[model samples]
Target chain A: MQGFALYPFDPPGDIAALRAELRAWLAVNQPQGDIVARANCWASFDADFSRALGAAGYVGMTLPTRYGGGDRHPLERYVVIEELLAAGAPVGAHWIADRQTGPLILRYGSEEQRQRYLPGIAKGELFACIGLSEPGAGSDLAAVRTTARETAEGWRINGQKIWTTGAHFSHIMLALVRTEDGSERNAGLSQLLIDLDTPGITIRPIIDMAGHHDFNEVFFDDVLVPHGALVGTRGQGWQQVTAELGLERSGPERYLSSHALLAALIDAAGADPDPAVAALIGELTAELWTLRQLSMSTAAKLAAGEDPMVEASVVKELGNAFEQDMPRRVQAIVTSGWDDADDLARLLRALLIASPSFSLRGGTREVIRGIIARGLGLR
Target chain B: MSAAREMLCDTARAVFAEAATVGMAPIDNAGFGLLLVPEEQGGFGGDWGDVNAVLQISGVLVPGLPVAALIANASLQPAAAVSLMAGAMGHSLALSIEHVNTRQQFGRPLGKFQAVQQSLAVMACEVRAVEAAAAVLAARLDAVGLDPLAADFEIAAAKLRANRAVGVVTSVAHQVHGAIGFTREYDLSRVTIPLMRWRGEHGNDAYWAQILGRQVAGFGGRGLWEALTAR
Candidate 1:
């Protein structure tokens, strides 16, 4: 309640029931279809799966039921998300909205905004994209130059957003725009939920190294929105976005991204893997558990409604490295699969192709390191 | 779990798990006390029993370093670590190094051989016995009044066990690595160097051994086994 603390990772009273229900649900509903997810990459979207999750009341789980949420704890939501992700459920479309935006609105949205947006978001009919990165402002959050000019109609937005994940498919862009053109740097920023179908907005796909159109570059051209769309006080964009990043950055997902592969690899290698493999796996497992505790602890702190920025940053920086390394080591071992009869070649091929983006996607390693240095008072 | 015991373990585990969440990673993963607060500042709250649980869990993770970190802490906590904290400015690490050098192997690091492992096994057994005795005494301390000096003695057993175990174990680990372990960033010494340094601090193996020897001398031959089973 005071300092940023964490929730307990131990199972709660209802956990056994929750686990059983969720386990059975997964068995029945493994996302397997022509358009369903293979690895549940948060950028990959499938409409039916999104709609089905909402129908099952699994969307916006931690928010209040009045807003169409299930009124669950964040940790409970974490368990659900963990299970869904591990099962490779087709949740890419709903992930951003459910994981970040719905909570953001609940925390800072006005009544009109909440009534208009949250229920649909919780129902998974509406999806959101964070429009923070730009051609010039990637990872330098404070450098956002997108201008939102005030007019009688509302705010006229004009800026270009880059690497907007799911932008091509999202219903709304929760864009951080520069308001007032104030010289306070971080002080002039504001978050605006601009409808993607707005007259002046344009979206174009950016194909990645993996040949996926999961990211995009979006342009805002005099896009008009009502004044009520501004989140919290207009001038506190920096503060609000900082809080948003904290939510995005930490938690179980940070380390669990490559866990499926880790589990598979460990099983293939068996216990007492070669000294090198065992050492690396052992190292990774220790860090994974440590990060799990740290993230869960931070979630507990946030559950008590406290800002655990430092602890969250510690988790993120460490998690970033751990996540990035898992795929690399997996690749190394899988590469050896060609020669070693004991190697699982098929699994190795999948890991070799997918693990490349491990460091770049979540948050860049460099960005996280900067946060860590600042967090440690080394800045 | 007793209410006091459960609360103590949970709170301490949560905080420690958090503090320990940070490190330089693989090289830094070999950490124990670095993450734990000092015992007197209401830190490392788990008693001898906690130490045993920690060791058991340690066996699961980095079987080698997990034990190494705990042993390192034990070495530091009692003989050298406590003394250093108490303002014992400078001291030599005899017991720590002697175990490393004198041990024999395949013309290698006794610090590097299987024979050292045998020695290390003996040391581990000693640490285990001392930890068991201390755990019982810790429960006794909880039930009775405070005896800071007796507590210090418990701390001593931990250190003696730690010093001997770390010295012997690390030497063999280093031996297995050969020359590569000598590199600065190799992660080999992530387990070895710290043990070496801490063992050298105030008292290494022999330093703590003398203390145990004196206690044994005080009770004639009965001191060794009696002090161990005193719980």
Candidate 2:
């Protein structure tokens, strides 16, 4: 919190041209879907579109060329993802694998794991889900009761992971499980790269309030994975997961997930809007600009190999509030019918229902604020 | 920050410390008015980055002074005020953190309480956001050679964002300090009062909002994204 400096978001090798190329590609290739799908496009799954994006060398931009990746700079990857999100691309199919699992594996996974998973992930063919929250551990991630026992044959796992996003569609699960016999809390936990196709694995859909099957309840009934499934150190899952979250919490996705609504609102307002509408647009723009600065700086810090956990949390906290507030504020100012068919009305309706989950997902608002408080040395 | 800016900040801190007591005489004598003037013309050849850093210090040490007026022209005041507000809000957050960490309540430091922690976290986010806004605004100004019209979007956005942060930073800073922060003798008032004043000084919330909103509207929906990325 001291000497807050804006880390320069200087991506290498012709960023403007890169943006133009991506925009041109998206113009020709991005799927024409339901207008509402554009609001939270990350959650809009389209396997073909993802494959096309990967073919265009957009996915897995940061991984090494040895693993079938482009070997681009992390900031370059940041630019591509932000552009994808802002354009409302249906990136849901391979989002998790591309965002964290690919990088995490390249950083910590074994050679065999990288050889097996990295190529598929880079090709947008292998999807992944995080196995963190359970029925007993929502915000208290350390209260995980999931267990995986090492044996002469393999690691035997038996657990239930609730609220697991993309589990139904994912090819793998990066699971955090208790490994030590009597360990409690965050100790002795390990991350395992479990293939979701294993026997005794079940992924049941859990429909969200928006009527979208974005998350699921995954059950592991004596599922056995090879000993090679272990990622990083044996007992360092908490630290690894904490580092992974720094990647998760800060990104353009935090703010631009609902960018379509703002775009639609602006378009609907026309050139000379009413004073109230104009003022609302102005405030939202200011917030969006400030958030871009914060998010990019956090991304820059992370790219420089610095741990930006607190700054990441600050971006998450503020980005969540902005995205969450956009709809309610629009509702307050605009006089649109609930069941209207116009694009603005439809977007407003969709975002009003979707905004609550903005703060709740990734991390709850309270949890994020607590992290910031700790960063401020208040706790 | 560059080494040159660090040195500039050091000079600013020393001059502002003196100017805090006597008037703007020390700031004038130190030649801060010539900060943005070209070095070939016998001036510092400073950029907006220099002004931003110097004003932040001016905000923390001498918020009552007209340092921004001396350094920048009338048009750039909004941007200048944003840096000042960022500095003042950061100081308020720092002071509040110190007070809560030291002040005991319920047989424990106030900072230990989740309620106080949450409030301060919110305040900290506002402070950090303003700091980021001011920094980016400075970069944009420097990139465009300090032309106000060229950097209009950044100016309005940064000023509006800083203005909006004023209420939250000042309120939460005082809330965490209890009645002690309300006193004239306490240092909290120095920053909080000026933060409140600066919010309304250079394009308040509504002022910048309408201006930015209309500009964004002119960009249309898709054009807004193009403009933002292009800049």
Candidate 3:
């Protein structure tokens, strides 16, 4: 809560060449599909694009080379991530795996777990989904009732997880389940990496307001997996999950999700835009630039082995507001019908529906603000 | 911050504390104007980073003084104003947090209330954003060898961002402080009023927005990313 001094984002090697190489590769490999898909492109799933990008050594850039990663710097990975998000790349497929799970596994997973997951994750062929939110746990994640009991055969799990993004398509789920019987809130929780195809497990699609099946309601009824499925130390799931959230909250994705809309608006406005459009563009650019600086500094702090929980929360809050407000502000200023099929119109319509979930996802607005308040030593 | 910059800030804080009551005489005598002067010129030979740090202290202690004007040129005034605004807004947030944690209502400290905590959180976010802008702008200015034209994009972005944040930062500070913050005798206005004035001083929202908008428009849509990353 002291002065928010920015940590310098000094990545190793030739960063300019890195960006250039990636841009060139993307120019050839990126799917030139509908422009609307590029708006919140990170959530736009394209397995092919992800695989190709991973083949180019972009995925899991921070992991060790032995794990099929490029062994690049975290800031280097950050640069690649920002470029991908800014370009509106369809990075949804491996987003979770590369972002948090891969690193988490590398950090907390046993050698066998890392050997099993990291290579596939680094290959971008294996997909992972978060299993934090349950029917009883949304904002109050500690209310997670999912239970995993150790048996003679294995660990048997029984519960339901709602709002599990990518679970329907994921190969595995790193879940927070109650492992210690009679355990209370957040006390007996442990993280278990469950293979989604385990017996008695089921995944049902939860179509969003936008009519997209990005999330699912996953049920685990007597689902049993090997004892090795446990990740990190038992009963440290709460700490591990909170650490993972620090990675999830503050990233280029928070702000750049709706970047395509801003780009579309600017492109549609032409070189000599009207004063109003110009003002709006200027305003958005200023906020975007500022958010980028904040996000990068947070990433730098994280890379420097410092816990920037407060700074990360600040980024998520501001970045979410900037992104959520972009569409509404554009809709108010621009004269575009909701049903219009043009790039700008369609993007506006899509994002207007998608914007509400910006603050809702990763962490809700209130929850994030509370974290900031606590960081201020208020609680 | 580097050791030199830390020492520089130490000097700034002490001098600015004295200059708080004596006006700019102490600042003038202390040679803050020579901060950006080259070492060969018999001055303190510092970068924009040093200026940013010193001006931030000036903002917190002597917001009414023309410390920014003395250190940097008119071209850099907008960037300097951002540092000042960042410093002032941070102080305002610190004041709000202090007020809420100390002031009591309904038999409890205001900070214990969720509503008050949420407001301060929002205020803290704005303050942090401005601080990041000021720091990045200083980095850009130093990277470009203090050339205003080379750092034009950062200058406009930082100033406009700071300008836009003034409303939230000032309002939240006052709201959380209740009536005590509004009094002239209170120290909140020392930073809040100066923040209100500095917002329109360098480049107001519309002014920087228009200039930045036109500049970005010229960069084109896809070109904007290229230009941003290139810098």
Candidate 4:
């Protein structure tokens, strides 16, 4: 339990160089669209854009060179993703695979799995989605009824996973399933890497309120996976999934979701704005700035191989609140009722619809608060 | 934590704990006022990280010290800023926790209620956020030795966060403690009153927020992100 330090956010010379290189590449190759449309940030999926990003060697940055990755520090990867999200780049296609799955595979995947999947992921040709949440088990992941029983033909899986983002397009799914029956809820659970196109698998899009097709419901009926599909040890799924959630919760993406809108709001507010507006914007900016520092500090701990699970949960919960509050604040400040065609108005409207999901995704507010309470020894 | 830093914090904690029980002044004996000054200048040659750790400990102990404010505006001669922000915030939280755990309203302790737990969780989050901001600013100061242009923005942000957190923490704490907390006789009032006063010290939330807002505006939309991630 190492105490906290103000983690340096100043990019090192090499990371600064990487940031410059990525910015230059984005300047030349980024797709043309209204900035508001791109405000969706990581949720904006573009396979071609992801391919371009991978071809440019920006994807799978933290992996080893043997796997066709940059083999850089996690801080380097952090710099890259921060830049991508700030610029409102469409990174959704390869986001999950690069951010969590690739690293996880490197840690726990077999040599065969590493050779087969990591290189593709580094190349951005392969994409993945999480399959931890089921229809009845969202925040309470231990209640997942997805069963993957072993057989002569490897393992047979039968269950459904809801709110599986990018399931329609992902090439792989890391499914948390029950492999054994036990009195303990977390016991006997295991994570299996299931290829999305396998037989007896079905995926249906669950369009969000913002009319985004980023989420899907995936079903499996006797879907057979190879015996080698299991990740880490069986019955260790609880630990592995918890670790994965740490990655999910503590990233630039956690707070940068509405960054584009904020930038636009600042632009819309103009210079020498109303006192109330200036203060509101300032408060939000201060909170956002502080949240980034907190997130970066957690990242530093992760880079140092510390769990910092409690800190990660705190960042996610607070960041979720800030992100959710952003649109309403903007709506209050910019009350002129601009035309729907205006970029700022459109982005604010988009965020208003999307804001509710900020707290709901990754973990609900209640669940995160419970985690925080437990961390503080209050429970 | 390094050996020296750990020693400094432990000494501060021990002194503050003693000061909390006795009516003695913690700063008079703790030597925290001299912690930031270099040894070559006839004071303890400690860095910002050490001072920050001590301040957080002071917060927990509610030692009613102005060590942070003294360090914040340290001159050739140490001047009192009379700010007890950290100590007050920490003390209020501690009092609330103690109150909820020992004081029962229904069939169980107050802390056993879900509402009280949620409020305390939020208060803890605010405190942790301020701690993080302070640590970040301290690290930046340690690295660059207080370049005004860079350090001012970070300092403003940290102050703003701290001021804001004190508001939430003090309010929730008093709410948890109920009417007893409002009385001067109660220990909670000792911290809560000081916190309200400290919220205006150095700079209040609104004052620092305006400064931060101006800086963010000066950076423009695209450049604002660069300015924030610059360090």
Candidate 5:
């Protein structure tokens, strides 16, 4: 096993050029409006914005050019997303498909599947959501009760997936279900690329406490799917999903979720803010830089085709903690009371409300700790 | 790892293991002092990453020895060896984990307890943070030779994080070990004491945090983010 040595964050010249290009494009195309509107970050949905991003060749950056992508490295994609998140661009509509689904399809999808989905995904015309978490199976996905039975024509699916982000707006779902019954929790599971338009599939929005309709409870009631929809081999859903998480947990989104809020806080704290407040900002900034380095290292590993599951988990665990802690720390620093009308106060309010989901989304705090413990051979 | 670095790490590990049992005096003969000196400068022209790797391994193998400090004094500045100190702190953490895994209480290993697990988990995270900070600093030092002013914030941040980590790690490691860790008979003090001492050597968390605070304040609110992501 290779030890966790220090990897340089020096991007190639082309990657730097790509960053410049992306910044130029974002300057011209990104929505210009209230700072609070950008607070949603990855959760903010705008189809036209996503299409414009795709048109600029920023969406499917890492996929092969043969499939309408930029044929760039994952590090290039990292640079693009870093800029996007830093600018608080609304990328929610194409975020999942661009980030994970496109690459996943290219890797595991058959020629037919890839030809059918990858181009649309690359074009940013298709959106995707994961179907791993069921009603009782969030972190413990092996307990998934969703079943997909093989039929002569295809496969029939039945089960409910809870907290499925963007499922209502998605074109497809890479559903994980039990294709065979067995004693082993992970043995019989399989991944199915289910079309959201398939018969008997219903996606009902679950309004969050903040009144955001991003989360949905997707019901699969005898939904029919073709045999080709099965991704990879049968009984390999666990492995596939675990592999997918390396991509999921290793992105800038993990730590940059509340970056807009941090930027807002800094902007609000003018040049001559309180010394104590400045110190707090410095500490947070240092931590953010540290986390970004860790994250970029994981991206480097991914580019080298390494799983880095444990390292990715580390990034998510720490990144989530930092993001969730941002609002409270900001609240503590900005001692001068600002009314709700103040943008800084409004951003802080939004973050405080949404910050609780930071850890809960990618993986819960307990689950992440458990993963870290297992990685350390403690369990 | 380069062939030279691999050989150096293996040799250091073996020497540190022997030194751990015999005494700290053998560390001078371990060839760590000559690690960072350029070949042209009558020393091994080793990479900073390779040197830091040895430092971390040395930390784990023989935490009591001031071998890393000696290497730091020989290669970089007295205050610049925080990365090596971080490696030493990691060794202390590794020692604690080993102790907790083997130390049984009430017919079970102490690691089986949730409280112990949580403490160790937190320790592991701190260890990771220190490692990350140190790695970033090492990379920066390697890319551009250690100009103290250019790398001031990074060096300070690494030291501060490592210093803070040592406090948490030692507290938890000692907590997990109970009274034995505090005694001289047990080897845990070898690492814990040095961690406590080394944290105060370059700059303690409070000291560096104040510097970093002033630096950030100087950058103002908007300039702070730019300062952080400058690299």
Candidate 6:
């Protein structure tokens, strides 16, 4: 409907059918009010709304049913994520849980861990966060200085994690720490499932530029954990963490962050879009389609059980560039002040405020270029 | 265009895997370059996609194979390269260099001095131009069937850029490599050797300028750029 776009291939889902189903679901299950609006959607610390997602079985649709999932295709999960993001749904709370940690657990968790955790995760009864980044060690994950020493009971984790989104309100954090006594730096890293509510663990919110507590600094001070807390085999955490990063970095979420903003901006432009505005839309739309196909190709590859880290990096890097570029272009097209707050306008305000972190969040642009260079044979 | 491109890329990927050989040889050897022409065109069906893929895959063997005459022809497709494609070895790619070889005001290897940085930048510009143009054109080729002559212009531009500048980049590479380069055993020539050969084999900027000029004239002043860039 936007333009004569060459989507090129049949969209994976029957787009209309699924969109109609979701619209009906939303109409029946709208959130309580403006406070539970898109700004903080699922992440408004809204217990009731999260429970609603659980009841609707909207969480973790791709994992096995034994773990409270629909066991559907990854593309189905993609459809859900894209729809939520596009509608400006408050997915911030369970976003990390559903996106990265839940899948990592499913693939690498101990049987007991899977049975104890994933079902609640799929039900939205539980939330998860990641602790891969540290104050001194940001993009260089292997440089994580978190140290975990074995105690009489389990391992005691003693380190701090920065950029731990949703940690102040999260239930658990799957953290990577140096585990082995004297091994290769990468070899010593291992993932531990730490309870956020446990004593000696502190989570203090870091107000980002938008003044939201969406991100936090979490400190682990001799935190007690049982041996069952380890997510996977010891000494293999680097490889496991690498695999998890691939999952985290890839996905439609990488590209759809600005879809809501684009929609609002385009709608605001009205029926008589001038040639300049239309051209911007055309170019942006074409690039976005390329990203969608590349993302879908990665999903297909994953569904076929291949690790698509390199391809996923390429998609995320290119997609994030497009995402970051959208707001600047939108600002130029609209005459209104950017800080205006009329529902969709508020979403654009939030997106403009949040756009900088998009490139820095999963990985920096420099790191991504390094990856592409390696894949392109330049490195 | 998309269908044509997909088929060509898929087939080229398959052919390279089928025909390529031991480390460092496929690039420098004539046996492989001969495949650039279509097997029917007295040459192999080696297209730009194959060259791009080869450039990408070339890194799977770090520092990559030497670019030699045939590898150059494989990508640029000059008549001499076409001749080589027809099983003639054609003219060797050896360059007649006239590097000052002496230190100047800086008392350093003239090649090592900052004065030559422009030359290095120019060479780099050439490589950069080719890579960017190739990617941009590839994205477009998926949409329409342009005349091969249209692609011929693009390839000529890229080859000119590559040939003109590669000498600078590769020559400095040898200067940096030092006596080891002169030893002839070091693979330093792995990069420079192909730069020299490809430059001469493609008929260089002089030959391409004339051809491109003639082609543009025949287009009645509507050159490839004008056609391609038209909204």
Top DockQ hit: 2
Candidate 6, residue A23: CA error in Å?
2.9
Per-residue lDDT tens digits for candidate 1, residues A108-212, read 999888888899988988999998988988767678899999999999998899999999989988888899765456877889878899898889999976577
Q: Write the per-residue lDDT of candidate 3 for residues A1-379, one digit (tens) a residue.
A: 7988789899989999999999998899989989888988878888888898889899988899998998999999999999999898999999999999999999999999999999999998899999999877999999999999999888999999999999988999999999999999989999999999888999999999999999999999999899999999999999999999999989999999899999999999999999999999999999999999999999999999999999999999999999999999999999999899899999999999999999999989999999999999796
Going through the candidates in order, their DockQ values are 0.03, 0.91, 0.88, 0.55, 0.44, 0.03
Once superposed on the true structure, which residue ranges of model 4 sit more than 4 Å away at CA?
A1-13, A181-184, B13-33, B57-84, B102-106, B147-150
Off by over 4 Å in 3: none
lDDT string, candidate 4, B1-231, tens digits = 789888887787788788777734666665666776889998898776776677667655654654565555542111111113544565666677778888878888888777888888788778678767767766777776645455777777777777878778888998999998888888787767766776776677788778778777777788788888676
Question: Candidate 5 overall Cα lDDT vs. reference?
Answer: 0.79
In the predicted model 5, the residue pairs found to clash are none
TM-score quality measure for candidate 6: 0.63
Q: Please identify which of the two predictions, 1 or 2, would achieve the higher TM-score against the true structure.
A: 2
Chain A TM-score vs. truth, each candidate: 0.89, 0.99, 0.99, 0.96, 0.96, 0.91
Clashes in candidate 6: how many? Answer: 9
Native contacts retained, all candidates in order: 0.00, 0.93, 0.81, 0.51, 0.33, 0.00
Per-residue lDDT of candidate 5, residues B1-231 (tens digit): 678778888888888889988877677775667877888988877767776777777766776667766776533542345656666666666777788788898998887777777677767777787788878887777777755667777777777667767778888888988998889898777777777777787666656666776676667544655565556
Mark the regions of model 2 whose C-alpha exceeds 4 Å error after superposition.
Answer: none
Task: List residue ranges in candidate 6 displaced over 4 A.
Answer: A1-16, A32-47, A182-184, A343-345, B1-231
Positional deviation of residue A42's Cα in model 4 after best superposition, in angstroms: 1.1
> What would the DockQ be for model 3?
0.88
User: After TM-score superposition, what is the CA distance of residue B147 in candidate 3 from its true location, in Å?
Assistant: 1.2
* Per-residue accuracy of model 4 over A1-379 as CA lDDT, tens digit each: 1233555554345776787889999999889886765675788889999999999999998889998898888888888898999899999999999999999999988888898899999998899999989888988888889899999989999999999999999999998999996525788899999999999999999988777899999999999999999999988999998888889998988888898888987787677766776777788887888899888888888888888888898888888888888889889867746457787888888888888888888888888887776665565
**Cα-based TM-score, every candidate:** 0.63, 0.99, 0.99, 0.92, 0.92, 0.63
Worst 10 residues of 4 chain A by lDDT: A1-10
Error (Å) of candidate 1 at residue A24 is: 1.0
